[model samples]
Structures are given as C-alpha cells and as structure tokens.
Target: MLIGEVARHSGVSARMLRHYDALGLVRPTGRTVGGYREYSAEDVRRVFHVESLRSLGLSLKQIGRALQDPGFTPSALVSDLIRWTEDRLERERELLERLRAIDASAPTGWRDVLRIVELMQGLDSASAARRQQAVLARSEGVPAPADVLAGAVLAESDPHVAGALRWALARSDGDGMATLAAGARSEDADIRRRAVLAIAEMPETPGAAAMLADALRDADTRVRGHAALALGRRGVTAAVPVLVGMVVEGSNDVEAAEVLGTLARDHGCADRVVSALVAELDAPTADSATRICLTQALFELSVATAREVLRRLASDDDRAVALVASAFVGELDGRSAGDRGARVRSASGRRKPRR
Candidate 1:
C-alpha cells in the first residue's frame, strides 16, 4: 500500500505518517518509481501500534525508544505513565473544582469570575489568616456564594477559618446550605463533624431542622452533641435526650444545660428534660463529677420538680454534689427574694397615693 492508502486506512494523517518516518518510528519499507513514500503491510501495522501507544499518553520520543530498543523494559515506563496520568487527573480535578466555584458564584461577567477565583485561591491558601479574610472580606459587602462557602466549610481544617466559612454561609440566603447535608452524611467522621457544625448554624435552610434531627443520631459524639445543642437552642423537644446525655458526659454540658432550659419552657417538654437529668443523676454509674454536672443542669429547669430534685441533692451523700446543689438552692432563693421585691415595688407604685 502507498502512504496515502495507509493513512486513509489507519486514520493517521499523511503528514503525520511522514513525520513518523523521519523519526524512524514507522518508516515505510517501500518506494514507488516516482520516489513517493510507499508503505508495506508490516509498516501499516507499525503505524497503528504507534497510534495506540500515543493514545496511552506516550511521547513520540518514548514511543521511538519502546519500538526500537529491544532492551527497553515497559515496567518502568508504564509506572511513569501511571504517575503522570494520576498527576494530570489531579490537576484536571482541581481545575474542575475552580470552574465549578466560579460557576456557582453566578458571576455577571469576567470581573466577578476573577474575584470568585481569587477568593477560592485565598480559601486554599496556606495561611489561615488569609483563608479567614477570604471568607470574611466582602466585595463591597457582597459575600461569596453560599455554595462556595459550603464547599470551603467542608474542606477547611483550621478551626478559625472553618468558623469564618460557616459564618459566611449563615449570612447568605441560606439556600445553598443544602449542599452541606451530603457532608453531614460523609463517611469521614471529621467531615461529618464539620458538616454538622456548619449545618447547625444554618437552621433556616428549608430542611435544616430535619437534617439536624437526622444528625442527632450520628454515631460521632461531637456530631450528635452539636446537633443536639443547635436543636435545643431552637426549642426542639426531640433534642432533650441528647442534651441530657451531653450533660452526663460533660461535653459542652453547660451549653447543653442552657439549651435544655430553653427547651424546657414548654411545660410538656420541660417534664422530659427534668426527668432525663434526674435519671442520669440517679444512675449507679454516675460519679460525683457527673452528679455535680447534673445538679448544675437541674438548676436550668424552672419546674418545681427540678428545684425539689436540687433540694434533695443538696443533702445527698457526695459533699461536692451536695454543695453545688445547695448553691443552686441559695441562688434560686435569691432570685425568689428579688422577684418578691420587684412585685411589691410595682404594686406599691400602682396604689393611689395621698394625692
């Protein structure tokens, strides 16, 4: 076959075939009377083989050596190719993430696109301060898109930067916070912890409450703890049990107790909160420290049950717990005296004076 016929059959352009010949990669083993390049059957087969290697990302120089050097081992070259391909794939993935971030910004033109890209770079910066400023610095008070913030919130490892990212997300329209729900379910516990923390701050998102509700059951203590605290602060009664557990565990138990008190404003939910705390105090496994924490948690409740429990605990066997309970009793008494004084003054003022 002539070069033209070989080019047509092999889909390798004629010029490329000539270049291959010059490179000694696939020189045709024939020539016509006119001195035009001619290809034998074996030469055509070599052309296809070169093209196949090229498809596998082999350089022309590498292809030349592989086809010509009988001593060349493919193992080392194949390993190099694998590493190169992986690096290329990783670069492509980063580029794709950058593009997606820009697209999610919903930029009106190239300027907005550049700004978003710059912010993304800042978020990825090695400096934690730069990353925080990236999330906080507004383009004339226009925050980064919530979706962009959501992505950063999940990827950020620095506690300060992560807090900034979450604040940015919370300040946005909150619609994009939906993207964080997937992170909440991530197999990585750290990611799930981050997701729950971010989601906890975005309770206004459409399903934010339900997402948090689901997170309350997460196996991670931090995940469940954050979820419960957020839910309890929002007056969600379902968080009562987890909040109570957090009190026993002393994991942000003070905040948990405060939230429980907030949830306890509802008479029905108040009973459950009080009962759960009292039960933990009564558990045989409850040590003195746990009892003290529980006693403090009881002080958060407004119900007579909690105060009565505190009074009983004020005389309990453990001196430390008894002292904390006794202090709460005194504090409660002080509050009662203040309340009575305020009421008497108001009633005295309401009365018709001598005038």
Candidate 2:
C-alpha cells in the first residue's frame, strides 16, 4: 500500500502519516523499484497502533517508547488511558454542574448565553475522549495537578467552575515534587511562580526542603516571597539565611519581614533574626517601607533585642522611621507618650526656625 492508500483506508490525513513516519512510529516497510515507499499489511497494523496510542492521549514520544518495549501491551495501556479519561471527564462534569447552578442564580445576559452555546458546541463537536485529550494536550508540561487547576481557574468566568477545577486538580497528584520544582526554572515567570507556590503547598516529601531553598532565590519577587513564607509555615529554620538575604536586597521586603517574624515567633532563632532585621532597619539606604516592616517584625518578635532596635529607630531623624518606632513603643508601653520625649526631640531635630 502507498501512503495515499493508507490515508484512504485508515481515515487519517497524509500530513499525520508523514508525522508518524518522522517519529518512526509507522515506517514504510519497503521501497518500490522506482524508489517510492511501500507499506506492507503489517505496516498498516503498526499505523493503527500509532493512531490508537494517539487517541488514548499518548504523545508521539510516549507512544514510541511503549511500542519499542517488548512487554508493551496496547490493551493494558488503553485501560490505564481509559481510567485517566474517566477521571478527567468526572472533573469536567463536576465543573459543569457547578456552572449550571451559578447560571440558574445569575441574570441571563449575552455573555451567559454565549457560554452555554460554547459548552453545547464543545459537546456536539467531539467525544469525551477527544475533549479530554485536547485538554491534556493544552496542559502539557504542567508539573502538578494544582498548576493545571490554576490554569482552569484562570479560564473560567464563574468562580464555581474555577473552584471546582481547583478542587479536582488539588486532589490529584499527577507528578512528583521534583517535577514541580523543575517547573520553577521555566523561562516563563508566571509558570515559575505558580510552580513554586504549588510545591510550597505540597506535603513534606524528600528533597522538598531543598527545592524550597532553591526557589527562595527565584528571580521573581513573588516566587521568592512565597518560598520564604512556605519555609516559615513549615518551621524550616534553614531558610532564615536566605530570607535574611532577601530582606537585605529589598525584594518583597514586607513579605520577607513577615516570614522572618514568623520564624522568630515559632522557631528558635527569634533573637538572632530579629537583630539582623533591626540592623537592616537602621541602614541609611533602607527604604521607609523596610523600616516599617522591621518595626512590625520587632513587635512580633517581642524580645529584648527587638525592644532595643525599636528604641534606636525611635530616635532616627527620618520621620517615617520615627513614626513606626513611636507606634512600636506605644504598643509595648500601653501609652503613646512614653516615647513622646524621643519623638519631640526627633521632631525638633527636623524643625526649621521661622525667618
């Protein structure tokens, strides 16, 4: 059989046939005397296998690997594929049900009408397997179920649909923490940020701490901040040095300060971390926000070291610094005026005499 005949018999396009040939998935059995390719009956069978694997949502690479294996069994692969398809379908069904509920409550509009029509069109145009395959393909390379779920959330207008997808994705652990961590190195900042956050929420597993530590240095401020927060939440004190570095760099300093405060409060490094954060507060180049965050963090630490830092900042000439210092002193003293003398002195230092 020629390529044309194979296309005609198999109901697959010539372009796809060429694709399979390129992938070595369905190679020609021989060549004619004139150098044209010829497919044997067995070659057609191989094409069918390729098509079947593709229909079951296997990528060309995955199919190639399975086909090359001596123990490969299409029936077993198909069964597993069926289970995955069924699970995806159930998720979509749950999402649709939630959307239906929301639709009933909301006022009907052109947008709502269009959404219903689109859903109907999707149902009319393809079988459930095809739909699931399309969805899975679109979400290829997503590390965890949560990352895919986050994408689904972004796709839907209804919160319920988004929420349902999130629930489904979260419940399914499709990939390991290592895969999710690798996604953190993706060139796409958004993907990297989401991947880091997903791993942060994952159950503590081997190498999870190391992955979090690596994510703490991510170029994206949000990714780094979330990594720090995750470490603090898990009471992983090893992240303190990295969090302190972020504080010094002024990247998401507020979040870094909060995480440091949490570390100080729950972990044993309260005194040392608080002292470092206070030193940062006193730096001449430190921003007003950094100083404010440091002040708040000191309050959270609530130790003698923190109190001393607050006292020094109270007399700093920067008005913003003085204000935060006054607030901290007031919070601790039960009255606002205990720091009043220092505040007056600082204000006088900044005062200009009338001409």
Candidate 3:
C-alpha cells in the first residue's frame, strides 16, 4: 500500500505515517518508478502497531524504542504509561471540577471567576490561616459555591478553619446541604463527624434536620453526640434519648445536659426530658462513673422537678452520686437563700426612713 492507501486503510493520517517512516518506526519497504514511498504488508502492520502503542499514550520517541529495541521491556513502559495516564486523568478531573464550580457559582465576569478560583485555592491551602482568610473573604465578598465549601469543610483538619468553612456554607445559598447530608453517611467516622458538625451549623433546611436525625443513630459516638446536640438546640425533642445517653456516656455531657435543660424549658417536653435523665440514673447496670456523670448532668436543670429529684438523689446509696447530688442541692439552696436574703434586706432598707 502507498502512503495515501495506508492512511485510508488505517486511521493513521498520511503526514503522521510519513513522520513515522522518517523516525524509522515504520519505513516503507519499496519505491515505485516515480520514487514515491511504497509500503509492504509488514510495513502496514508496523504502522498499525505504532498507532496501537500511541493509543496507549506512548510518545513517538518511546514508540521508536519500543519498536526497534529487542531488549526493551514493555512491563516497565506499560507501568509508566499507566502512571502517566492516571496523572493526566487526575489533572483533567480537577480541571473539570474547577469548571463545574465556576459554572455553579455563575460568575458574572472574568473577575468574579478569578475571585472564586482564588478563594477555592485558598480554601485548599495547607495553611489554616489562609483557609480561614479565604472563608472570611468569600463571606465578605464573593461567596464560594456551596459544593466548594462543603468539600473544604469535610477535609479541613483545623478546628478554626473548619468552623469558618461551615459558617460560610451556612451563609451561602445552602445548595451544598445535600453534599453535607451525604457526608453525614460517609464510611469515615471523621468525615461523618465533620459532616454533622457542618450541617449542624446550617440553616434548618428540610433535608438537614432529617440527616441529623439519621446521624443520631450513627455508630460513632462523636457523630451521635454532635447530632444530638444540634437536634436538641433545634428543639427537636427526638434528641432527648440520645442527649440522655450522652449524659450517661459523659461525652459532651455538660452541653448535652444544658441542651436538655433548654428542651425541658418547654412545658410539653420538660417532663419527658426529666424522665429520660432519671431513667438513665436509675439504670442498675450503669457504672459508678456513669452514675456520677449523670448526677452532675442534673445540675443543669434548675426546675422544681429537677430540684426535687436531686433532693431525692442527695441521700442515694452510691457515695459518689450522693456527694455530687448533695453538693448540687447545697449550691442551689445557698443561691436561693442568698436571693431571699437580698430581697428582705432591700425591703428593710426601703422601709427605713432616709437620714
């Protein structure tokens, strides 16, 4: 076959085939009277072979060596090709993500595009300060897309920066709630924790509350605790049981207790919250330390019902529980007496004649 025929038969273009011949990768075997290049069957086969290797991302120089060097081992070259392909694919994927983020941001101009890109880079920066600054700048000016903030929030290891990122996501359009919700179900406990924390700060979007509700059942104690705290703060009484469990476990038990107190302030949920706490305290299987933590958790509740319960607990059989409960009751009594004394003194002073 001639060059044109070879180019027609195979997908390789004529110019590329000639270039391959000059590179000695697939030289023609014969020439016509007009001195035009002519390819034998074996030469055409070599052309196809070169095209095959090229398809595998082999450079022309590498292909030349691969074709001509009998000592050349394809294993090493193939491995290298795989690595190079992976790198290119990664780069392409990153570029695609950047484009998608930009599109989602709906940048009004090149300046807006540049700002978003810069903010994204800063969010991904190794320096936590830069990440924090990025979130601040984005919040103050061009808000980053929720997806970008979501990604940053999940991967951020720094507490400060992660807080800022969550704030930014909450302050943004809130389209990233789905990403955060998916992250709440992540197999990684750390990621799940981060997701819940971020979502906890988000506006109570329809799906966010449900995601947090699901997270209350997570196997990770931290995840469950965060979800419970968030739910309690949101006045979701469904969190009462988990909040009680957190008090039993002594994980953020103070905050859990405080949130439970807030829930108890509601006349409807108040009895339920007190009942759950007392039930945990009443469990026979609860260890001494757990019982002690539960006793301490009672201090956050100042209602008359809680005081009566603490008075009953003050004389309990467990020495540690009795100590904590008695101390709490004593503190409450002292504060109460001090308030009464102040009121009486003010009344007496008012009743006295001015000098």
Model 1 scores a TM of 0.94
Q: Compared with the true structure, what per-residue lDDT tens digits does model 2 show for residues 95-199?
A: 785465335425246555444434333323335443343333332222223333444333333434433433444454443454466667778776676666666
Assess each prediction's global lDDT (C-alpha) against the native: 0.86, 0.68, 0.87
**Model 2 steric clash pairs:** none
Highest-scoring model, lDDT: 3
Task: Please write out the lDDT profile of model 3 over residues 1-355, one tens digit for every residue.
Answer: 7889999999889998888877888889999999999999999898889888889989999989988899999999899889988999999998998898899988888988999898988977888898899888763556678998898888898999988888788888646986887788789999999999988888768788889999988999999999999989988999999999888877898899899888888636877877887888888899889988877777787778888889999999988889899999999999999999999999998895879
Sort order, TM-score high to low: 1, 3, 2
Poorly placed runs, candidate 3 (over 4 Å): 139-141, 334-355
Total clashing pairs for each candidate: 0, 0, 0
Estimated TM-score for each candidate: 0.94, 0.48, 0.90
Compute the lDDT for candidate 1.
0.86
Clashing pairs in 1: none
What would the per-residue lDDT of candidate 1 be over residues 1-355, giving only the tens digit for each residue?
9888887899999999989988899988878999988888888889998999999999999999999999999999999999999999999998987787667667788888778788888887889999999877858544477777887888889999899888788877534655688898889989988988988877476788988999999999999999998888777888889989999998999899888887787636877888888888889999999989888888988778888999998899999998999999999989999999999999999999796
Model 2 CA RMSD to the hidden true structure, in angstroms:
16.6
Worst 10 residues of 3 by lDDT: 135-144
